[model samples]
Target: MSIQSFKFSLQTLRKEGGISQLSYGIRVFIALCGAMALSWGINQIDMVIPLFLGIIASALAETEDGWQGRVRALLITLVLFIITAFGVRLLMPYPWVFGISIALVAFCLSMCGALGRRYGVMAQATLILAVYTMIGLNQATHEMPIWYEPVLLSFGALWYGILSVIWAALFAHVTLRQALTSLYIEIGLYLKLKSKFFPLPTRGAVDSLRLDLAQQHGQVVVALNRVREILVSRIDSNPTNPRLGRYIRFYFIAQGIHERASSSHYNYSDLAETFFHSDILFRLQRQLSEAGTSCRKIGEAIHGGHAIDLRDSEETVAGVLRSIDYLEREAEPTQWRLFRSLRQLTDNVIALQQELDKARQLEDISLSDASQQIPQPRVTFRSILSQIADQLTPKSQVFRHAVRMSLALSCGYAIIQNMNLSVGYWVMLTTLFVCLPTFGSTRKRLYERIAGTVIGLVAAWALITLFPVEVIQLVIAVTAGVVFFLSRNNRYVLATAAITLMVVCCFNQVSDGYDVIWPRLIDTLIGSIISWLAVFFILPDWSHRQLPMTFAEGLRRSADYLRELMRFYQEDNVSEQVYRHSRRRAYNADALLTSTLVSMQQEPGHFRRDTELWQRLVIRSHTLFNYIAAFSAHRGTLIEQPSNQLLADAGNYIVESLQEVAQCLEQKQLVTDSSAEFERLRNTLEDCPSDDDERHYFVQSQLQSLLGQLEEIRRLTLELQVQVHGEHIKDVK
Candidate 1:
């Protein structure tokens, strides 16, 4: 709620670069122009309303999905838009009835978002269409036929859909490349932050570096999620396209590189103490930094459509080799261990370089083998219905948001109806757009909504007064629409300003533009204030209240990921689908927790009493995740399998312990002593086979690390419990 919040938001927005933005801008520009030309110039449609609404749909339907998926989504959206518009127009003559209808429809439409992120976007777009239908109904004046509104709305939606499908068809590969490049760039940035930890001889660097890494890792997860969505959706639709085949292959390679590149295998303190006298630490830092640079260079090559240069990577490897040779005197155990870790790290970097080289030889390899790697799930009607039905509960955030939004919209609608304010649809529009799920988002939207409205109204007034030309104003309105869609996700304030201007300017075609400005500003302010009050007093789902459960979910998911890793190693035949799915779930869960932790920081101070404790929990959770990732990377390279019984016993103990922690967090109970499991795992590790002790030693190190991490997690969770519930746990040494 402070100015710093807005500053941080702006800083985050600044990071989105490259072709994703360009393509979106192009898509929006093309969609708007196409709609305007078809409506205004050729078809002579009714007042460009359908075209404007379709432009809105085009903006909302922006996804990293393939052309086929985009088409599917838009077609569904077109159907929903027609239905919602027609239904609203049919009921508008009855005030009380219309209000009730709005409530019910709003709730149902909002609930559609509960299905998932894709459904959420479509549902939100349909909700906006519903609002637009209401506005259309109010403007009908009883003279126009009911079909007039819905038909025009459907036309605009269809127009945008066609344009989007066409854009995706033409630039499908380009879009895929952009998404991949973005993913790689984000991973590169993550590697850079990770490299900061290599200079761990500096005092107090570990904690700060881990904190920074956690935040950056959260962003990398988001980028990976986007890349996965695009690649998976594409491969699912048609697993035959060579280009898509290549894209998926590269995606898997990037996934591997990300896994190995970002793991903090050796504790920073351990590395620092073991290499304090040697310049090997500095060389290791340089190697990591250069490797990060190479990753970024690969991204640049992808973006620029050129071959990736590996000279820097070669130099880095050579430097790391020379440094390793200089450390030949392995006089101590720690020194040998450090040397091995550095060698493994160098190998990971080399593997990344080799992956990049393979990506460069894209056209030389047949991707027939790659298609078998990804399994596509069959989408069915029964499954869709089941998914929708599953969300029909109070616990789902989407459901609660649905209820909350409907109530807020109803209140706004009632205010507009009672006050009889001119241009009152803006009030409802503002309220609908402002009521997001979390308070932080709602608060941010409110601030941006009010500020953007005032700024937009003033700017539009000046434009209208100066130009006073219908054609000029129309062009400006179209331009504003495109800008609105382009900036909607990142620069909300800019989006609001552009959209407000577009709406006011378009409305001016029916009313005086200058006279409408003040009403628009006043209505926006009123609507924003109402939204603020609603979010504050309504079923406010505070992040702090949700943090404990979220943190527990993070632990559970990380444990699930570890279980999957163990399964991959224990079984001779590994299922890529199972491993990848579990990995994605774990990363997504951690990312969700990380984002929530950030949101909680911006909440009221009273709700953030345990901020420090929450940070520690997040760091520990992330570090635990990194440890599991390391085990996953090393799993494939084991020369001999360790005792499955011992591994199974340790994995079960960890999983059960994680479940216990999750339950305690949710139930707000004090944690019980859990040292017996840890001790047992340690004892099992001690009784390893001496014949293949080297192989067993690797397993021992991994399991011991896992145990140590679990103990730390237990302590952190107990500390959090004490902070939240004032309960003291009995110490068991």
Candidate 2:
């Protein structure tokens, strides 16, 4: 049943009109190949049928584009043909034919860019190649010979359109496979990372990782749908995943625990008070010890390049697998493998701790000096500027887009000018990679482009054979009409398909444009190659890094924000509220960067370093927010029993004061600036230790942890602040 449904879905995509550039380009090839063979039998050839088909097919490319894409394509053709007839002739040799042709084509493409990225690129490529052909052949400045020139160009255009249909089919096939592979990669990475972060077989941590992994899978759905957009409707309109709500709802439970922990208002604990105590310490030591042994084995495995054993990837993957001789029982294979991996991960965590300790020791100098400084005034102008730049065009992305467009068009131009190249028609091939999904590499994109082209050619031929020559013109007309209607909805690819069929019908069925097929095929191949080369070699945006770094930055800032928020909740220190905007700003920026990265991935290849950093920033920021949101709502309140009310109030006091002090040190220096509100919270904690109860026990449980986190925050802040100030600060010890 699933297989049948999947097949049905494929059929839907194939039958559907409106696709993107890649599909459109492929269909163009199909229309040419189909019409040429059909024309061999017909005494009379009219291009009207093929032209109409091409438009309809192109319109279907973008499902929602409605009739806009069809109109856009027509407008582009109309405007360019007019300009080539008038503009190219008058300005030739006077200002140089190259400059005029480039400018004219560039202007036309830029105008059509309103449709979408691929459309603009294709228009420019087509315009340049067509004009170059006319110029290179030294055709008359005035009117063309009615018989051959128009017929040939029209037929060539029709063939190019047919190739697009073939391209669409291939794209649909490849993307399905890619989506599945991506899901497995994400699952593996999640399991591996969790094995390192949570060295124990604790139910809580395991469940947490499981939930997060599920969310990751949901996100992959969005990514997959986005890729599928190449052959279907844009995914932006799709519904959000149902599993997302599960994570959010589950977070409430953790949130209660975190809140209970954060509510210690008068916490004045030192390192000994909240530092690593017996139970948690014992757990850590054991895990680290086990992890070290595991790491050694994993290293050996890595060196040997063998698949390690596994139990269940999501379950407990640690401890020695014991074989019971009496019962004849052994650890399951999955369990054994998982344990092996976890063991190796534990070793790495221990190794990482050594580096952490070294960094901690390096911070001995600035801790004391940071106690005496005051805060800096906030910058109003920069904040205002950031808020106001809503409509600002991203210059780097735009410029690179334009330059790449230039390279593709130039390739088309070179073929027309240099070789009178029949391959000049290949300019249509460049359209396939122009706006590839996933910001993938141009090489990979080109491969897809080539595929779509071949398939579209075949599809167009099959359609032509079924319809035959007699009514093909009618079919072309109807396709044109549909392309016109649907392009308004942004279904450019469908429109392109219709347009391809129409062009082929017009050139072959309506007129003998099939005679020009040989030259057109060469043009198709050349254009595809040149465009791919341009995108592959030219200065590319490091997309992967950008999205990741943005995520990471957001995560780091959110952590700081959460700490401040916790301070406010615990000690009534309202000051932490002032820094709230910092995290918000970081999140907003991260979101924008992520959106861009998602869009760029379709472009092709390795992402730039900064882009990767931005992506990391996004991931980290999301992690921090998710972690905090998962942990608390009231910040310092607890779900468990309390030691005493007095202890509770004290914990609250310390949490606030320390958090404020830490936050202040992040931007300035921390002075002994405890407010009346903070003092009140301290008094409250001092008063609360009457008897053991839920509140009292809760306070007792969280007291030490709160203090430790505060000290850690302060340590981090002092180190950063000192670096900002100077290197001569004296040691605190």
Candidate 3:
């Protein structure tokens, strides 16, 4: 490639997270090379294995944080490494003492996850380092002092930590930029998925599409959370930086766009049935799809550090406006209710376009809003201890997982001692990597571990036979290490294969690599079986057990969101922070329920017998959330009209019904039906006069839609309750 083109390609890749992955790989390569060079220079080549293992552990412990945070994390990691390593050394002679000590250490470390993601990762890495220390002890010679391996391992971790901090300092904004880029891309995909509803597909297709949209929404929420963390870190570290302020404004813009895009004005099926013959639905679909494309283009610009040109987006908005004008002029008065919804959808699109335009010229924006400050959690020692203490129960998933991991590791160690395998630590290592909090994840990892090991062993044999030179093998090992880091999150099988190949190559440096292959495979199988058994039998966190609480949470958040919207309508001045906070919590809760259902699907069939009912509940709950979003989208001052009282009554009824349903689900009691009350509200809504006020009319339509959605939701919740608790509910006025 030409130099200019190559540079452009690199910039694009960086924006799309490719270069970020490459940067991670490079860091690992650099750390490994430094350790190899230093060990060979000092003629202490025996130390390279421990150093390499420490480097890997440190890398695993790393989280996305600013330089300051990284420094803090690094200190904690180093301290934990020292304690774990030396503790292993002191207890190594007594097998029983060592096994019980490691089990206790495992539970304590696993419980550290209650502190936060950062501590959880560090704890996991520390546990793995303990296992590595065991492996190193097996290879120790009498000439090596007891403190030798622990000190060198700590230094190896320090070496990688230094590199990470330097990288964070130099590229402070890179992670944030990547995160924002991903957020916009996910939002764009969500909009496109929403566009599919306009085609008026079959019921099955629509339900499937709704599920897909929910999954995509989850991704958007995850991206937003990541961006929130990075922005919070950077802003806290340097509050006065203009660049960070601009990024904060960009984040708020993305939030606005997501809220508008996620809003549903009316039922898609009903809209399609009413306007199937009209080109207006098609026009709206085209506009939404184009808006999605614009979002993606804007994301690309952000990634590439290029100025955005939104002339195309402007044209798309104009086309949508023209279509709306045409529809308004030609539609019959009988379809005016649905027509109003169409107009609202068009307005939402225009607003989304405006947000995109703001993002385009974000350089000129200033942070004027007081609510732009992202809240940071206070991390006092007492608070940390409190968080950990809260998780110290059998009901806590983290607690259960900790107990399971401790027992599994102890069992694996016993197997290792009894069998006297050459590299029994590999079995423990496999258990660590394979065991997760959920049955589905653990099962999936078990299969991938076995398959990847077989592939890696076969590939390693072929490579060693073809290229027997030690230097070539070393180069291959480094490359494999880089690949392993690059693909670890998205492609577990490939990562497993890459790491397996690297292990073989590393072992070949000091011994016959072929001898390690069979033992590696055998240890993996043994470990996989142990992890599988542990997760299945020991406090298995089945998703079915949590679905009721999850469903209730979703319902309660939806009601809270509606309550906020009602307050916004009733009060003169509501805080944007409060409204946005409620909206985000509602969306997050909906996303969580959807994800939980997905996890349940991956579990055994008997555990998910109510899957269909749960699916319907999710659809109705999200639909209710969408109706509230629509009301939020069109929030405006309504002059004191007769309809205002009706609106208030209808809104109060919907919120109460939602809360009641949530209460019933949580308590596993029968849901009380309010269909008669709902019908009376619907009749009152239909009888209310519009008084030429479009805003009032819009509010009435949204309330009407919400009432219907709540009725369906209540019915589904009742059916689900019956399925879950075998209770029959009766209608109550």
Candidate 4:
């Protein structure tokens, strides 16, 4: 192959493997420099080895994302560490004295995870590394004392942490850019699909939320309000920065799409009327053209007085082109059904664009006030559990996905480990392979493992030839830097490869780095195969099924927690306490929702449960939670009792229906129809005569609305089961 062809093929291979191999050469150069500095710094007689605490510091201080920030990351990391650590630790027994000491350390960490948030996650990971790494490294015949190991490990961790902070702050732009691009792509996809029918076997009849039929329009106002906030700030950022512009425009389009789609979800056959016609399509085209042009002009304005030349921002240009493409596609004779919805979407986009301008000005004026507006608190325990239920990022389900490949990962890992070929890469590759949120995780794990291994070999060959083995110190420094970069992403594959490359290089350097490349490359291939087998066979992640169960659990738990909270509120002289279990409940609830959203993309089958009836329920639950929180916040000035019978009735209905839903799910009899008497009561309950006359005297004034709500929900429960499960409801006679 030509040198240019070889290089091009190698680059493509690395990217396909998700290895970021192109970054290796640069890293090696930096490492060589760092080695020179570090060697000199250490060579000075009696000099104290500099503690590289940057990684630790960065991990600690990172993320302005609130609560779920460091804490969640830390928890997952710790869990991963324990799994690995325990696997090896069982090979030998520690002295009782050391065991006791470790137990104390473990206890302290268990308490920290309970504290929750960024701290919990970060601390758990650190402590796990601290504990397990200490044990693992000690297997060396000339082991350092436990105390010394912790100290040294801390220094190492700290150094890496600093690198992480620097990497995340500076180069995290790459990931952010990709995310922005994805947002746009997702938007375009949503529009295209929504333009068509829902693809149900029965096409003419639509299957949407019964509740949606009641309040679809109610949603547009709320969604537009939220979308406007992110939309304006994003579009108003520096447009000259391509990375920033890409992200901002992506955000604008996604928010606009969401607002547009939500209007459809809420309104009846709004899709048929808005999308299935031609005049509306033309109208939509005119509106979007105006809006897109205005947006392009505004973007130019942000590009520092650069006249609106139209070619500066690729992202802006691309967004405009996409808008045009969508419009053109709509103008086609075939997409008439989309015409109606497209026009409504056009109107929302226009309105939201105006709102964006207003929000931008208001944002500046409200900056200080906004800062004080109680940034979202740490995700409660309930939210966290909820996330688990929702299978937000079912990293664990990497097993049980695809059979052919899962067998491959298991067989691969077992064989490579038996062969003793530095199976660390295999372990890591397996981790990555199982993370396909939307794709088949099992297949991805095997595919990525092979791809990464091949890329690593090629990258190593190139980088090793460029830097001599004597530059060992440089290799370490550069590897450290790359590791810093890796921590910026959740996947951490690229950084892991960087660290792996250095270790492999370390083994090579010790052998005078004079070895031919063929043997090492072949070994890497073997290890890669092992990784594929481990993920595909032993621990294949069945991502699709996990999301549904996880989400359902979170919803059930959230409802249970709310019921408990209400019970607590009703008792007089009782202290309003957020108990530990209740806190767990809350954290799980939020976590589940976040996970639900995350996993929805990864596993389609599982996610379908959420998109259907559950969406209506979850969203309504969110409203209930918000209202409850608001009520609790101002408990002192609250009404002596809820005077609104309808409101109280709605609340009761929600509580009861949710309780039944939970039981139905738990019993695995989710399709069971509502009992005949309850069905009659539900019908009677819906028609609240005189908005009060309130057989109302029969209900608790504070809970009358809740009761009414429960009845309506009971009716909905039956309808949804029929809709979602295709279970026939027996005659209510």
Number of the candidate with higher lDDT, 1 or 4: 1
On residues 411-484, what C-alpha lDDT tens digit does candidate 2 reach at each position? 56656666765434345335433433223655555555455445434445556656665556455544554443
Clashing pairs in 1: none
Question: lDDT per model, in order?
Answer: 0.73, 0.39, 0.82, 0.39
Which tens-of-lDDT digit does each residue in 1-733 have in candidate 4?
1223423432343243222223323433343344345645667211112122223322433332212222434345434444434433443244444344443443343334333333444544544354334323432335444344344434444444333334444453433333333333223222333333322114223323323221322232222323333333333222244434333443444344333332321122443444444344344333333333333343323322333332322333345346545756646665543333343344344444443343223212222322222123445778756644443232433112222233443343344445554323233233323323234443444454445545555666566777664455344545554553543233344544554454445434324332424444554456455544444345444433444455456546656555554544344443334432453454346445544543444443643553555545444443333333322221222223444344344445556666666555444454344456455544554454423232222222223333333444444555555665554334332
Please give the distance, in angstroms, between residue 171's alpha carbon in candidate 2 and its true position after superposition: 31
Candidate 3 ranges beyond 4 A from true positions: 1-19, 141-143, 364-371, 727-733
lDDT of 1 by residue, 136-212 (tens): 66654347776887887777777667777888888777767776776776677777677666657365566666777
User: What is residue 104's positional error in candidate 4, in angstroms?
Assistant: 11
How do the residues 372-430 of candidate 3 rate in per-residue lDDT, one tens digit apiece? 55666777989988999999999898999999999999999999999999989999999
For model 4, what is the error of residue 572's alpha carbon versus the real structure, in angstroms, after optimal superposition?
26
lDDT of 4 at 180: 32
| Highest-TM-score candidate | 3
What residue pairs clash in candidate 3, if any at all? none
Candidate 3 global lDDT:
0.82
Name the best candidate (by lDDT). 3
TM-score of each: 0.91, 0.42, 0.94, 0.49
Candidate 4 lDDT (Cα, 0 to 1): 0.39
* Model 1: lDDT to the true structure: 0.73
